[model samples]
Target: MLVNMKKILEIAEAEGYAIPCINTPNEETVRAVIGAAEELNTPIIIDHAQVHDSLIPIERIGPIMLKYAKEARVPVCVHLDHGSDYEFVMRAVKVGFPSIMYDCSALPFEENVEKVAQFVKFAHAAGITVEAELGIMASTDEDTHDDDPEKRVLTNEDIREFFTEPAEAKEFAERTKCDALAVCFGTMHGIYAEPPVLDIDRVKELREAIPDDTRIVMHGASGVEFDQVQNAITAGCSKVNYYSYMAKATTKFVADKVAETDGKIAYHELQEAAYEFMKGYAKDVIKAFKNGK
Candidate 1:
């Protein structure tokens, strides 16, 4: 069934698990992610990143995502990931996204709170679930990061500077009334320069401090070890955004399959194989975040 993020995340929080929110920028990914959720009989969130707009505009993919969500055996939430621009976020709302991440973390704390608070009012009135970011999430993905080499190689200590303060998280959640708040602890997006170490204690602190209605969220979970990821879920994160590593793994899988087949596989066959691979990959992610629930 198609549902808003708040509905699923509420259950996740109560049940001691985190829902895996994956980026599905194309039809194959949409099918694979939903397929995985159905197979596991678990709720899943499939998001279209604003950054992937050039690859496939929300206008073109929004309905497709909603259609699949409505038809899926398990609940699925179609969300807008990192919708930094007001206009772009409105576009997702117009396209009928049930959930959206209105990221204003780059702005000053007061400005970020003001912007999200205003949007939350409008969003809640329309039954849309709003997600806001409290801290700037670091990125190692070349596409999302600066070209400066120094910026990409972040140590554990470097990431600590971006960690969300529990008291600040409480204030942000209370003021904005967001359904979910993404906070930085230790993970960075894309392939990790070094294995990411999650601040599990921070997650617990944030959970305790933030409003009960506002679920804690962890972004850049892709490269982190599954054990650490699950620990975070147990500590408090109810929504985990993962994708970078999964996408890269899929690419390598397709390449290896082509080589194994000596390039004799038909193009459609290759696509189908890739889709199958991703379905299984997504299942593993869902199970891991479930934290044995």
Candidate 2:
């Protein structure tokens, strides 16, 4: 079913595990994620980012993502991830991305919130859900990886100003009326050691501070202590974003498959394996969110 991001998050919260929001670099990758989601019999997220070449031309990926959501037997949400570009964001709304992440975390506090408020208006009017970011999370710029992930931390002092404080998050929600909030608390965009010691208690507190039904999103969410799948769900992270890992994992899977088959791997066979691997990953992740876990 083609549900909104809010519906998916509700499913996650009620089910006790965050839904896997996989990033697909291309058509094959898209198929791999959705295929896995369907095979696992769980709802999933298709995340799109303009800055990532793997996700250029939202015009191309948007419609295709929507199509897959419609075709899939399980629930799915098409999300525009971390795009600060106004024109591109508007375009995505027109093209119909059910959810959007306006990454103004890099901007000044007031400016970021102002811009988010403005866009929230635009998105809500269109019946599209908006996800606004706060507190910059650090990651390898690919240009700057001196090996210390600590170098990328958004100032702890600045974290409060950059994003809505837990008390203020509710007001921001009421004023901007955003459907979801992506708050930062020591997560990095790329691989980092030990998952940066998550303030899971803070997350729990924030969860209580927000509107009971409002969705909570966590970005830069890969590379953690426990499985990324399990930890987020337990922390009450409703919508978890996974990008770098999914694309890289897909590439690695293909490369290894080709090597193992001695270049004799057929196209369908490779995709089939990729799909199966992802499905198992999704199933394992969903299990973490299950009540017994």
Candidate 3:
């Protein structure tokens, strides 16, 4: 059934489990997520990043997502992720996504609050829940980096500047009136070379600071240590966003299968093969989040 993040996460928070927020750029991935949720009988969030609009236009993807959510036996929330552009956010709202995350974490603190507050007002008026980010997340796509300076490892200075303070998180949630809060807790997006470290204590502080109804969300959760994830969930994180590892796993499977078949399979068949891998990965993630509920 189609649902909002507020209700989906409220149950997660109360039950001491987290729901996976998986991003999908196509029908294969969408089917995998929804199918996995059905098999696990768990709630899920399916999101599309606004930056990927060129590849998967929201206008086309939104309706299909709604169709999947409506048909799925488990609760599903269609959400717009990391939407920095105001016009694109409006388009996603028009497309009837149950939730929208307006990422203004790159701006000054006050400005971030003001911008997200406007989005919250607009979204709430349309009966949609808003998720706002309060910290900086480093770009994880290696292919998008420039050759000049090359990509540097994330530094402690960067973390200290961007990591959300408990008090600030409380203020941000109250100021924006957002339904969910995405906090930065040292996990960078994409593949991690040196292993990721999560501050579970920070998660506890954020939980105590924010309103009981405002759910805590973790970004860059794809490659984090599962034990750390368990700790965070135990510490009151109710939602975790994941995607990069799913893409990597699916692509690897498809490429290996193509090589195994000597490139004779049709494109659609390759996609079907990839979908199988995605479904497996999604199921594992769902079970992990729910602690095998």
lDDT score at residue 12, model 2, on the 0-100 scale: 76
Candidate with maximal lDDT: 1
Q: Name the candidate, 1 or 2, with the larger lDDT value.
A: 1
Top-TM-score structure, candidate number:
1
Error of 3 at 144 (Å): 5.6
Candidate 3: residue 37 Cα off by (Å): 0.3
**Model 1 stretches astray by more than 4 angstroms:** none
- lDDT by residue (tens digit), candidate 3, 138-220: 65566445453345456434555567899999999988899998898777776665567787898889999998867889988
Ranked by TM-score, the better of candidates 1 and 2 is 1
- How many clashes does each candidate structure show, in the order listed? 0, 0, 0
Candidate 2 scores a C-alpha RMSD against the true structure in Å of 3.6
lDDT of each: 0.93, 0.71, 0.86
**Candidate 2 lDDT, 1-293, residue by residue in tens:** 78778788787777777776777656666776777777668888887876763436888778888888889899988888887888878778888887888877778767876888888887777777788876666655453456765565544343333333677666666666677888766566765544355667667777888786677777766555445435555867787776666556667988999999899989988887887776566555444445343
